[model samples]
Target: MSERKKSLITTINNQRKYSQVAKAAVLSSAMLARKNSSSRGAPGSAAPFGARESIAAISDMLSTQHKKPVRSSYVESDRVEWALKIACTISMITVCLHTPRTIELFPPLTYIILAADFISVSVFMLDSVLRIHYEGIFRCDSSYLSNRWSQFSVFISIIHLLSFLLHCYQLIGKLHFSEISLILLFSDKFFPFLHLNYRVWYGVIRSIRPFIIIRLIPLIVKFKLPKNRIEQLLKRSSQQVKNVTLFFVFFMTLYAIFGIQLFGRMDYHCVQPKTDPNNVTIMDLAIPDTMCAPEGIGGYECPNPMVCMQLNLNAKGEGFYGMFNDFGASVFTVYLAASEEGWVYVLYDCMDSLPSYLAFLYFCTLIFFLAWLVKNVFIAVITETFAEIRVQFSEMWQKKEVTLDEGFRKKLEKTDDGWRLIRLDGEVEAEGPKQKLQWVSSL
Candidate 1:
């Protein structure tokens, strides 16, 4: 080619590249202007502290960091993003299987499980960092952290990360690295106070994995169902279910406190060696030593001891768990009694030597308060919330009228009254139906 032709071709290529870049810049600016104009009248639109400002700040930070636009979408259309989600899911499952309980179930695979867990955790950490960077971690009210479910998911991941660090610390201690570090540092002790069971922490971390499913709402929402039928179905009961759950938790806590004060401190020991004089009662009346001995009539097995020790023997009587022998058992027992699910048996178990009337009255009062009163209150709250939500859903469904364009092949127009379905011959369906009725009447 001639030198003039080569120069012309280069100019054309340069012009095309510049044109593309110009188009991108124009498109971005137009989108920003459109968004700003649309949001002008909205709440906090004029305020610099609004969501748009925060979003712009985040976007600027991300662009500064990567020199590129960050991709974000409510739908899972991107293959790379979908692949990452799947990888995270698989990694979470792998870590869950390697929990302490599951590890104990399969002892021989301990090392293999631990190795998989570590690899999965590393992947999770990388995934989290990527997500934070993409979501603009510099902004306090960024979309990622502003969302409740996102916050929950990130919090759990952070806890799991800490648990992983604890695992590493445990490994270091097991390998006597702590001792060597002490010698190297020329100190008497290296992290002497850093003592914790990493296995238990890992188990706790694994238990929190189930909550990650809440953050998978976008995936479920993205499903191509007919008219968002799945979302409608979920909406029907979601609010009521949430209300019931909160009420149940509140009542359970109240009942747990009641049970702890009432029956939790009772110690059932057949042989009462000593007793507090001021605290002496008829329940403290101990059976003869012969009766409690191995060769005795009861054979040292008293299902319901008549004598009660002043000191609690329930799991060393230390923390709440120790004091009750089981943290949730007291609440559960009260619940079972309130529900009338074998309340007689529970009361019988506690009423061997104590006054039967007092115990019966105490239980009957609890049944009245929890079963009759609280249950009705819970029902009323749920019913009211459901009714309100039903009204809102009806209003929303009715208001959700949509118009569709079926291409230029089908002519369409709107009238002052409502939409007028137009045909090629300038006929309207509403007029056609009326004209047909008039013709029939004339005949």
Candidate 2:
């Protein structure tokens, strides 16, 4: 019985040793397979590199290879950027002040103003180029030529260059105190079409410089939260505002067309009385020109011994007096009435000219629809958009606060004395009150 027990034990021990060796062999084979899979794509391997990683590596290499190096101190300095900003402000002010009439009136200071414009434009062009080079090329990983900001910089640079050239051309004329021979030669030879209107083109180009004030938007946003909020509000409400504008314009145009058809050639004024001085008798005044109404037909009469004159018929000479003579004038009249600005006099004039009292109904309907209904709709749209933005901002602020509180809780720990605030690096920062600890623990 003892011998049989010994044999059984020996057999069991031998089987256990064999199972252990098999397990060791399986683990070693698994480790070798993992090592081989890891080192599959070496320098002398038949397999190629991973497609995704290869493309990423190539893209990184190319981006680093193509990026331009910044060499100019002026392009890198913050002071230079501020200086350019000041120049832009001065340029805007100069553009506002230096009109054609200003140049003609202040002939003695023309050269001085021209010099300032030249300097400002040069600075603008240089700054635009440097911005493209530094911010678009040196700082960006993408190609500068394809960058949108670089494209905008290029366009602005072209405008500044054109403005500078126009300024130089004007300076040449100013230097001669008239159109110089060189200018005439160029104008006649190269730009005969623009010769007469050279000043007009120059004025147009110089006027564009004032739009550089758009650059100050960033500075305004940095300093004022109200401006940023206004920007956000405008962005969010742009589509609604566009719809409202379209509605207003469509109704305004419809009313204008109706006014033109209803009140066309009807606004008559009595002027230039041709009375006989010797005869003291008041004879009936015959309508000389186009009459507003037939003789004693609509109770409309010429009060004075004057000729009937259509004041609104003339295209020029009479300014706003010609309100509803043509399509353009009719549009202006309807727009004015819709805005409720000086519409009472217009209504009375229409009443005197027309054969009936339909003008009252027309103007009342226009004012009610546009001024009351459409204007209120626009206001409501803007108010709703503003409210939505305010709520979104409040929610974002609450989320930020909650995140901060959670992070603080994560960095807190209980100690023997109280609750200690531990940093991310496992260092104790501060100890807090037991109540505060309990509050944080509750969270």
Candidate 3:
């Protein structure tokens, strides 16, 4: 062959070798990445495949070898599982609908509710057991028992067991069993003086059945968009949320302390004087416009000492109901005022009781800080965090798309050898073999 032709062939051969080497390198890197990913059994590190896992693997192999393949037609379908879940949900809803009054008034409904409870509890127990067996034994997950779902399952089982016993007690009560026999069977007749009313205990257990609705959380979390967004929001904004909460609590406590100091002992209320025809004075006839403190305090005396009764300042005149009875009560009252719900009444009471009108300033300042400023700040923080998270997700998605596009372009470039060959033919036609030969020789 001519020197020019040989030089051209050598140049093409060199290019082909370079392409093969680059492809090999890429393949090798990909394989290495896959190996590394597969080797990593846990976060941040590789886990050793232990002897127990080896034994379990061997047992699984032996079991599968002996096990007969089941027909797909006979297999339990997802629809069946979902049906059971729906039924369980309905049963739980029925249980929630049953109140003590309903059970008492409608005697026959009690048995129906009991039956529903039994079905729901049984389904939950079965599901929990299957989950535990699958996660702990079949999957051989050591941390399965420590999982929140597993813990919740265990809790549900315990409560259901107690509820089942209560059901039995309730049934026995319906059977008209003697109280003495019941006390002996349950309490071992230890406290004969203590009244053992199984009915009341049964009612308490029934009340707790409403909490079974929490089981639906797993189903609710199946909604990917909302659930994932909520999870991301919480995870990314946890520190910000904590900071806001701390600030809110600190300010609330400060306002509550101020409230306690200002209105702690201000229990004065307007009381109407007695109007008797026989011994009626002008003061007695006058409307009770003056405020009087609770009895035993040396405060303003009313016109009718015999008949002036202390009026109830607020509904439910207990410590908790009082606006500023104690530190805890003051805190709750401050929360109410900050929420701006029925706080005008409290403000009026405070204004009426206190001699000065500075109470308005205190409340206005509290409302401005907590209700207006702090509330808006909290909303803005959450909104900003959500926006940031959304932007980050969008950027990641764009990067992924760009990477995919680059990979696709590289694939097209690799596959279009015919086009390259055609271009090379054109180049040979445009510049004769002698010129190509000289170029190759120079290279």
lDDT scores in order: 0.53, 0.61, 0.60
Q: Which structure among the candidates has the greatest TM-score? A: 2
Model 2, residue 344: displacement in angstroms?
A: 2.8
Tens digit per residue, CA lDDT, model 3, 6-60: 9999999899677655544433333343346557756656524232222222332
* Clash count for each candidate, listed in order shown: 0, 0, 0
Task: Name the regions of candidate 1 deviating beyond 4 angstroms.
Answer: 1-76, 100-131, 138-143, 168-191, 196-203, 222-269, 272-336, 339-346, 376-380, 383-399, 402-443
Sort order, lDDT high to low: 2, 3, 1
| lDDT (C-alpha) at residue 76 in model 2 | 51
1-443 in candidate 1: lDDT tens per residue? 69999999999989967755543443344344446656877775564423333333233323333233556653224754565466457556765666557766886555665565566566556666666666766586655677765667668677666656655554554554477444534432454454332334444655665655555556446532222333454676677667776766776677667666655544444544465534544455554311222223222344453333334333423223312234477776777877877777667644543445645776777788778877887788678766755544543343222101111123334679764334445543555887889989999
lDDT of 3: 0.60
lDDT winner, 1 or 3: 3
Which 10 successive residues of model 1 have the least lDDT summed?
400-409
Which runs of model 2 end up more than 4 angstroms from their true locations?
1-77, 135-157, 175-197, 223-236, 272-299, 309-313, 320-322, 387-401, 404-443
lDDT of 2: 0.61
- Cα error, residue 273 of model 1, in Å, equals 9.0
